[model samples]
Target: MGSLLSVFSGLFGSKERRILILGLDGAGKTTILYRLQVSEVVTTIP
Candidate 1:
């Protein structure tokens, strides 16, 4: 029981990890990821 509790606590205590975006070319994946990381507005044209 103590080990299970420790595992759960460890899992929940860590910070969120970096996001992984997978897509084909011209899919705006890079644009979106950058925008989120920088916390700023990003502009792009289709």
Candidate 2:
């Protein structure tokens, strides 16, 4: 976890990677979050 955090921190100024999907209130923010956590993506802000 610490190393992962460092990787995110290291991307401080690099080009960002973003994926945006829109849906209603009960859509699936939780599901997306779960996938991201499991995938160990370095950073995501939204």
Candidate 3:
């Protein structure tokens, strides 16, 4: 929600932010996103 967005905004010092995650196939990109969302690690299958 608003608070979560604010945390990210504060980290990057911006009111608006765009993020892109680039990696090879099966390189755990989904895993990284999952970690960010939940603040924990989980297995991801491409």
TM-score leader? 3
Clash list (residue pairs), candidate 2: none
- What TM value does model 1 have? 0.44
Mark the 10 consecutive residues where model 3 has the least summed lDDT.
9-18
Which stretches of model 2 miss by more than 4 angstroms? 1-15, 39-46
C-alpha lDDT (0 to 100) for residue 11 of candidate 2: 80
Off by over 4 Å in 1: 1-16, 42-46
Counting clashing residue pairs in each candidate, in order, gives 0, 0, 0
Candidate-wise lDDT, in order: 0.81, 0.70, 0.84
Backbone clashes in model 1: 0
Give the TM-score (vs. native) of candidate 3: 0.54
Candidate 3: regions farther than 4 A off: 1-14
- Give lDDT: candidate 2, residue 19: 76
Give lDDT tens digits, candidate 1, residues 1-46. Answer: 9999999998988777776679998988868876877977587665
